[model samples]
Target chain A: MAKRITLPITDEDIKNLKAGDSVLLSGTILTGRDAAHKRLYELIQNGDSLPVDIKGEIIYYVGPAPAKPGYAVGPAGPTSSYRMDKYAPTLLELGLKGMIGKGARNKEVVESIVKNKCVYFAAIGGAAALIAKSIKSEEMLCYEDLGTEAIRRYTVEDFPCIVAIDSDGNNVYETEPIKYRK
Target chain B: MEIRQIKAETVTETVKKLFMDCNYFIGKDIMTALKKSFENETSPVGKSVLSQIIENDKIAANEEIPLCQDTGMAILFVEYGDKVVIEDGSFEDAVNEGVRQAYCDGYLRKSVVSDPVFDRINTKDNTPAIIHTKIVSGNSIKITAGGKGFGSENMSAIKMITPSYGIEGVKQFILDTVRTAGPNPCPPIVVGVGIGGTFERAAQLAKQATFRSIDSSNTDPRYASLERELLEEINKMGFGPAGLGGNTTALGVNIETSPTHIAGMPVAVNICCHAARHASATI
Candidate 1:
């Protein structure tokens, strides 16, 4: 059975995770992508007040479609996280606890994950409709001008993901290919 | 000489429907490939991931939602018949109108930014599609339209190899690109390899190759063998589904080649995600 995890995860929770562990995450998480990360990184560099709090929160890298009449948001799937690598370490230092996205991260970002006692989880990259079912509620936080790249808060339930990088900095994206290659 | 007059509105309507339908429906060839991949996948994690992707596609089809969030940039390939004439307006305007209607009416995401460099603002309606036109010797206008998501698109590559590099070099380059891409382009992916032609022609052929049915092979026996070999090699690398690890790394590899200058062998790899949304209409 997959392990179950709750949001605003503690360091203990992060430390227990190792790369390749399937997890079901619940509770609140923030959403951002390339544009939002650039803006947030700029704000930090300028030493200006951030629009949203990052302390002990997870940020999902996604840009979803516009919601239909009844849905909270449209199909919300994880985008590639490597584009955010340049800004990730800064966010980690500011108390960001976890990140949910897909694909590999660079060396610096992985090191920051270990140093910050944080975890990186990967949702299925192409499984947008399936993933969107987990999002129970969503509200815009800031950077609405960025359109779908805008920052928002999402309340998810049992959001499925795999631990791509753990606090020990063991990265599944690195080790898995070696083990599975024919 | 007989001229077949086709109203611009008819072209617009056809294109709009094609884009909308392609986004909602997974092509039969892709669906078949996914099922086969699921059956052959050795890893339990890979198998389950494939199942989820299959289920996700079904949900998108039945519920009328998009298969992936990155609805992508509009790309249209127009094969204009020499004998056909648009009665009301210009050919480019008709194609753009179709794209605008499909993106807005179908509720697809508008991902086109106005400029590549300065002022990278969303075009809002996904207008000014990347349309490539070729004049052919028929009376019908054949349009192949699709949305190309950038997640995989960004992973694509191009190289201008000297004739001395040969086929072995071509194979190695493809292998390197897929290996480096790993899990990023949303495996299992459809790889489109464009060989020969000039630099821009190679890139266009690579893009065009992605729209072919995954089950089809190149007409030339030599290139078909190369396609099969590349597909086998890619799957062996074990990027699996979502790169979590497994044998089903790539679904298909389509190669399209044209005669090129004796001095240069331009090659381009255009990677399309499994969603590979595309539909064609001849009217």
Candidate 2:
């Protein structure tokens, strides 16, 4: 059975998680991608207060499709995490505890994951429809001008993911491929 | 000289329907390949992930929703007959009209930005498609419309190398590109390789290559074998489905080649995700 985790997660919750563990996350998480991350990084550099609180929150790297009538969000899947590598260490320093996205992260981000006692999770890429079903509700948070890239908050139920990089910095992307090679 | 007068409405209507259909429906060839992989994939995680992707496709079709959120920037490859003439609107206008309506009515995401550098504003209707038109010697016009999401598009690369690098160089580059892309392009990708042309032409050929079905092989036997070899090598990399780990990293590697100058050997790798959403219409 997969581990079941609820959001507003703590360093303790994430530190106990290990790479390759299947997880079903339930709780409030924020969504952002390249554009939104850039804006947030700029705000931090300018020493201005962020529009959304970062402490103990998980950020999903996604820009979902527009929802149809009676839907919370449409096809919300994880975008590639490497694009956000530049801003991640800063967010880690600011108390960000978890990240949900697809693909591998850079070396620095993995280091930050270990140092800050956070976790990096991978939701299946291109499995957007399946993932979106877990989002129970969604509300726009900031950067409305960014369209789908806008920051939104989602309350997800049993959102499926794998711990790609755990607090100790074991990375599935790096180690898993080596085991499978002929 | 005979001029084939084609109504602008024909182009607009065909394009609109193609865009919506391609986004919601996974191509039959890709669907079959996914099913085949699901059975063949060895890793338990990889198998389940493949099953989920297939299920997602089914849900998108039954629900009439987009298969993925990135509804993509509209890209059309037009094979226009030299003798054909649009009766009312310009060809470009009709194509854009079709894209505009499909995105708006289909509830697909509007992903195109008006400007790449400054102001980066959303066009709101996925307008101004990236169109590549080739004037041919026939009366009928053929349009291949593809919804290209950027997750995979961002992983594509182009390089200009010396002709002396030859076939071995091309093979090495293709493997290297796929290796670097890893899971970022979404594994089990369709690789479109363009070789032996000018920089722009090679890039165009790579784009055209992605429109080919995953089930089909290159017409030329030499290139066909190369495709098979590359596919085997890529699968061995163990990127698998979703790159968690397995033996099915790439579904197909399609190569399109054109004659080039003596000194130049330009190659482009256009990696497409499993959704490889595209459809065609000829009128």
Residue B245 CA error for candidate 1 (Å)? 0.9
Off by over 4 Å in 2: none
Model 1, B114-183: lDDT tens digits are 9888888988888989999999998999999999999999999999988999998899888888888989
Best candidate, DockQ: 1
Interface root-mean-square deviation (Å) of every model: 0.8, 0.8
Q: What is the TM-score of each predicted model, taking all chains together?
A: 0.98, 0.98
Tens-digit per-residue lDDT, A143-168, candidate 2: 99898999999999999999999999
Taking all chains together, the TM-score of candidate 1 against the true structure is 0.98
The collision pairs in model 1 are none
Q: Which CAPRI category fits model 2?
A: medium
lDDT of 1 by residue, A76-136 (tens): 8899999999999999999999999999999999999989899999999889988999999
Residue B101 shift from truth in candidate 1, angstroms: 1.3
The Cα local distance difference test for each model comes to 0.92, 0.92
Please state the CAPRI-style docking class of candidate 1: high
Provide the global lDDT of candidate 2 against the true structure: 0.92
Best by TM-score: 1
lDDT at A116, model 2: 90
